[model samples]
Target: MKMTEVSFDIETVPSTIRYYLKNATFYDSSCSDNAKTVFVKGADGAFLKISKKGSLEREYRMSNFLSTHKVAPKVFAYESDLENDYLLSEAVSGEDGTSELYIENPNKLASVFGEYLSMLHSLPTEGCPYKNRTAEELNELTNKEASLNILTEINYSAIDDVIIHGDYCLPNIIMDNFSFKGFIDLGYGGIGDRHYDIYWGIWTLNYNLKTDNYKDIFLDAYGRSKIDRDGLTYFTQLIKLCD
Candidate 1:
């Protein structure tokens, strides 16, 4: 058996892929363009994710946290060097929501997305280490084009904190026949306002489906009788500013 090879985004390519390529498979693309992920189905199955060394710790921490709650993949091992990092974890056992099957069933997909998000947001946050505070978030904003005044101008109502999946998009969600499986790309997850995830969920649906016809369906499924239009606008602006 010969090892298979695949081109990854130029950041961190895995040397182990060459050794295991005969029995392993390579994923050239993922939701994140910044990192590289390769899937290997061995004794139990796993993903070998490679990325820059510094920030991979967050994903490792977050994955461990969620896995404890039975909400994410189980981490197998994590290792790193000065220039690159590696994360090996059990492969999520479901079809990605971005798959054509799910894409065709927008109503079912959106409903499941909303229900799973509700479950996620309901998790306890007392000891959770990650937080997406507004002040901290604003301070991290790097977009010179957006006004800093926008932050000051927005009057935030009392916040309700829950475990927010930072990048709650279609690709990150996994489903098996409309039943929720698990979440991937958890680097951005933390305790944050529900609106942040809501905004991204809506944005992702619109983006991936190439239409804005289903925001209400998702919101309804998420069971928000009182929509926080102001929070939505504010956080959307905040994310845009940061970008």
Candidate 2:
């Protein structure tokens, strides 16, 4: 994942870390070489984005991944510099949907997230042009064996054939009020089941974490009495292995 130093004259504008880049360890090599993402105000009163190399290729490849959804940040371009990669794009208009509003108002969390996530899953999967994952696909993705009974035990039969936001948790969900802008990190956005989205969304809240009542609130908001809780439990355990 290293890039050969090339003297590509792309005078990168100065940047700042408006917030923590999701993963610190791979912030450069695994995430972005110029991992310090910034929010700069332009003369026109709009925020412009500037990114440096690292995992630009992988990120760029998934640039269009979340385009179908109206909520994602609009990407401007990804071009090769002398010896590195660079990404330019428009900034998201609002704060992350998982902001103070939702956190402080935890009860509003599930209902808003429920309907928003459903909209994401409802996107047409036919011409998605992205990889769709299954239990078997996941198996090939890791050293641990993925289980097929994940759906059955989790009671996930009701929802299928929709896009699964691999990281459907809060951070990735950007919003201003109830207006969800779009999704980010298309790197993992692809076709799958409805439960996958809901499962992770509730698990990672870290607030009502480890509590079934909080998760139930989300389901209640989503208007569902039955879901594959077992499947979510399994995935949560699986994700823990990743940590």
How many clashes does each candidate structure show, in the order listed?
A: 0, 10
Candidate 1 lDDT score at position 82: 76
- Which residue window of length 10 is worst by lDDT in model 1? 1-10
Residue 240, candidate 1: C-alpha displacement in angstroms = 1.2
Predicted candidate 2, C-alpha RMSD: 8.1
The digit string of per-residue lDDT tens for model 1 on 1-243 reads 112446434234455433343455455444356786776655556777778886678888888899888999998777787787888788877787788888898888888888888889888886666875555566676454356677557776526488888899988887888888898889888888888888899999899788888887889888786457788888888888778
RMSD of each: 4.4, 8.1
Q: Which stretches of candidate 2 lie over 4 Å from their true place?
A: 1-10, 13-34, 43-54, 57-65, 82-84, 135-137, 140-160, 207-213, 223-226, 241-243
How much is 230 displaced in model 2, in angstroms?
4.6
Best by lDDT: 1
lDDT of 2 at 103: 70
Residue-pair clash count for candidate 1: 0
TM-score of candidate 1 relative to the true fold: 0.85
User: Global CA lDDT of candidate 1, please?
Assistant: 0.76
